[model samples]
Structures are given as structure tokens and as C-alpha cells.
Target: MTEPQGALLVGSVNYDDAEKTMRTASAVLGGRLRRIPDGEVGKRFHWIMFQPDVLGQAEGIERVGDEPRWRRDVDARPLRIADGVDAATLQLPPLGYASAAEDSYEIFRRLRDEGAIAEGIRFQVSLPSPVAVISSYFSSDDRAAIDPIYTAAMRRELDRILAAIPHDDLAIQWDVASELGIIERASGYGRTMESWWPGDPFDGLVERLAALVDAVPAGVEVGVHLCYGDAGEKHFIEPKDTATLVRFANAVITASARELTWLHLPVPIDRDDPAYFAPLTDLTETAELYLGLVHREDGVEGARRRIAAASAVVTRFGVATECGIGRAPAGTTEGILATHAEVASAW
Candidate 1:
């Protein structure tokens, strides 16, 4: 037996298409977009927003004499985190999306109706992780106040969005890389296990995320894509792992969703190859994992060897690009996605 086809090895498709495309939606478009000048979102922060003694740079909250740390607006609601060259990173609408969630669902439905997605492909609809949204726009100075607001806003948006879609046809993969494995240590965010970066407040971030997943309607398949920092292709960071990830995977099984997608790099860590998916062993038995076997750097031969190597360790596994194609050139993104399908199809 082989892994299923008709299965989609989907990665995060930015939310830009969700909103920009909405302008054309007769049913979704409400109020005049022109009323909100495009220049508003273009504004940038002039001062470093938040910095801590640990991460030295304060996790983007620090500032120089006069420059702003980030260019985020306290109130601007962006659909994605930021539109990178590859994908539109999305966020929950700032002002409650009373109807936009439904509208977003409708848009995806039409795509399927139009047969735009390949035949028999399963979808892992990408939604921004709530933690990333709050941290990005809201200054670290007031994250306590910002978190509640963010959660409420996201809950309403997801509640309606999940309600609108058919659970079986569409899958949900919340894009969150905040506490992804051992990456936190790279920035000096935390020095010991007892204390987490910034503060112990974010200690339960995974728990909160798990709750969000469990809160999803019983029908939609929910997946969690966890990775280290995703700044850019050649980001100034190294790789590492954490016991926390294993704990989260164990708890994730209780959630209502069917699948849990994990992002595993194809490269080696300290010359130690990821020959076996030891992490999957700790995950709940209920969900299936989409092993990220293909690399943005791989060719056909590399892909074949990777498939064989990854399959050797996985039983109930699917295939996908190591991570989102955001920032990767279009050609790289296409190759990464297409290669995954081709390799998976052969099985």
C-alpha cells in the first residue's frame, strides 16, 4: 500500500488572494474599499516596538534614537502577515469580520466548483496563527491587552469560516511558527526551561493553539504547521528541536481536526540526518502527518531519494514542500509543489 492520491500536498497559500480577490466578489464585497485609502496600510512604525533584555533586540520591540521598530498600524487589519514575493501571509481581520469569513469560504468553494484545483486533491486551507497576528501589529509593550482582542477577533472569524465550509472537502492548517521547536533559543529569548522568551506568559502558547483547533467545528480537518523562524529563504538563523513540540503533538490528537501537518527541513542538523521521523512517534495516533520531504533546493533525483528515505520512517504519512513557497522564487515554488505531487503519485 501507498499513500493516498486525490490527496493534496498543499502548503500555505497566502491570504492575499482571499482579500484582493474579494474586490471582485459580488457576494463578499461590501462597503467601498476605496473609502479606506491604500496608503493607510503603507505606513511604517518609527520606533522599535518591543525589546527585552534576553533577545537583546527585544524581539522587535527595541528602537534606535528615532526609528520605529515595525511599520504596523495598531488598528489596520491585514488579511495576511505580509505579502512576500511568494505568498500573501494573512491575518484575522482587525475589525471583526462579521461576514468576511463566510465570504472567504465562498471564494474557496467557487475555486473548487470551477475545478481550478487538481482533481481529487485535498485542501489544507491556511489561516494565520492568532499569536503571530497579535505580535506582528500590536506592540510588545501591550501584548497582554492585545492578545485578548486578537483572540476574540480570530474566534469570530474562524467560527464563521469553519461553519461555512464542508469539513470533509476542506482541511485547516493554522500557520504558526512562534514557538517552533528550539528556534526560540537562537534569539536569547529564554535562558532556561523554567522561563520562556519575553516572559513565561507565552508558555502556554501551544495549549492555547490546541484549544483553537479543538474549537473548530467537528467537520473540517485541522492541521498544525509548526516551523522555526520563517523570515526569508536565507534567514539569519540556525535549526534546533524542542520537547515542547512533542508535547503539543500529543495534545493535538484531542482536537477535532483530522490531520496535523509538520514542517521538517530536508537538511541536516549538526551533520545528524533526519533519517527517522522520531517526532511522529510522539504524536497522537489519530492524525496523519504530511512529511516535508522535498527541498526548495532539490532536483528530481534528490526528490526520489528523499521520498524513499522519509517513507522509510513514516507509516501514515503524506508529502509536501518543506515549508511555504513564500519568498521562494515562483519557479522554485512551482517545482517544490509539483515535485511533491509527482513523487507522491508514484507511490
Candidate 2:
């Protein structure tokens, strides 16, 4: 089979800081990556897990439990509107997405100027969809009231990021994980992810995500990462096939006004058969397809097997891990990066 070209870092590398993440990824991946993310270090090491504290800081919002819920070593308490406080009138504080991106972009720019990074590669900024955040952090009863407010706050964060970073060097990615749990009606991290709003959940999900896609200005590249919950390097539910992923990608493409630069889908490590990739033949959109087939355990041999399976349906694509390597075992990231470099030809 022909080697896939290019690679995508689905955000979060396990490095100690943004500078390390950028320098290491640039050194290891080189031209294979069209864009690079700043390891999502610090408080973002666990994606979206730091959000409850940020949300809890808002006026009229309070923590639901005295003790925090622990997951993967990070703790976060669920938040809700305080007693006698009107949810509709409440304003959310900054969610930290823009501040992180703006800060990281400086590192990215400095590295590029110093010739540590390639010129054409963009700096990728990954943001969680508001639905993913609202559903995960707020109770179902409080979701409807908090959704719009949070969404507006997130948009403002996006605006700040746009203002701070040059559009030509920017690429924005919406990380969509919890939406899959809701779509499959499965639970992740001991809680069921369900939509609080009435009506068809799938339609609502696609529309909301599409709106997010359109929120990015035309000059900046935008993409979507479709994921199952990756709480402990495990999906909330392993997919039966690529059927749902294909359907979701097609729907988002049709609903959105802007064109997607890329779309990434996860591939379970066990799925190396043609059956797992057959549905990709039905995908109608032309966005670059990235298959999350690189596994640290199996390395190049394993990625090759899945690549061969995917090649039967999709003629061209990129390679990535099923989820971010932020939570991967210590000392596994360099091997994972090597696997990507080996299986996929450098861009």
C-alpha cells in the first residue's frame, strides 16, 4: 500500500511546557506536519477538565459538590446556578481558551523565526465545542440556561485569538468528543452525555457544530476532530464501524457555510479489517481525511495494517493517534511520533 502523506496532532502532547512541545514536535515530525499544537500543557494537560473551576468563578455559579470528582489525577466539581440567582442574566468569565492560544502563539512564532520550525506550517489551536463543555460540566437541568451564555463567551475567546494571532499562521480545530457519547447514547467517566434540549439530538448536534465551523473567518483554516470520549486512552464506546463518523462528517459539511480544511476520525486499535473502513467510501465531503491509526503499542507495523485497510476505501489521507498523546504512558510519546514519521511520508 502507498504511504499516507502528512500528519495531524489531535492536540495535547505530554511535554512539560508549550516551548518543549513545539520544539520537540518540530524536531521529530518536521515537514510531516502542516500544523503543530502547543502540547496543551499546564492546566490543559487534561482537556476540558479544568473548565469547571473557570466556570465556577462566574457570578451566580456554584460548585455542586464539596469534594471534587477525580479523573486521571485531575479534579473538577460540577457547576450550577446558585439559589435565587437568575441563570439568564448571569455572565460567564473568560474560559481561558484564547489566553492559552495567544500565549502559545508567541512561542510558535519565536521558534519559527529562529528557524526551529518550518515556515509554511501553521500554529494549530484546538478549542472544545461549547456543547461538549456545557454537557460535561453542567447538570442536565442547568445546561439549557448555561448553553447560550457559554457559547457567547467562547465566541468572544475566539475573537480575541483572531485579533492576537495573524490569520495566515493560524488553524483552529474544534475538538468534538462528548457529542459522540450523546449520539451513541453512551456514558463516559460514569456519566451519560445527553442533550437537555428537546427534539432530535443528532440534528441539534450537527447544527451547533456547523455554526462553530462558520464562526472562524475565511482566511483562517478550520477543521473538526470527531472523537469518542478519551478519558483514559479508551473510548466511551468503541465504534461498530466508520458508519456514524461518515454520517456525521457529511451532515456537518452540508450544514456549514464554510469549507472544512480537514476532518479526523478515530480508529480503534483492534480494527484492522476492511469492514472498519468500508463506510468511508460513502463520505461525500472533500476535506482532508485523517485516520487515527497510529498506536504506541503496535508502532509502525500496526499503523501499516490499519493504513492498508483504510486505503481500500479512501485513496489519500493523513495519520494520527486515536486521541491526543497527552495521556499516553510516560516515555511513549517519542515512539508514537516516530511511528507517525515512519508510516506517513513527510509533507
For every candidate in turn, the CA RMSD to the true structure comes to: 10.8, 1.3
Candidate 2 C-alpha lDDT tens digits along 1-347: 86898999999998889998899888989989999999899889889999987888888999888887876555688788888887889888898999999999999999999999999999999999999888887886789988888999999999999999999999999999988889999986577778888899999999999999999999999999999878778898999999999998899999999999999999999999999999998997665779999988899999999999988888899999988999888888888998999898887
Highest-TM-score candidate: 2
- List candidate 1 segments past 4 Å from native: 1-10, 13-107, 114-124, 137-141, 166-169, 181-183, 188-203, 234-237, 240-244, 254-276
Residues 1-347, model 1: lDDT tens digits: 34423123334322234533222221221221101001001111111121111112222232223433332332222222121311121222333332434444565556647643333333345555666544544343344544654566667766665666565655566655554432254342232112123544444665667777776655555667655544544322444432344555565545434344333232222212333445545555544455455566665456566555544455655555555544455445345545555555432
Residue 330's lDDT within candidate 2 is 85
> Any idea what lDDT model 2 has?
0.90
lDDT (Cα atoms) of all candidates against the true structure? 0.43, 0.90
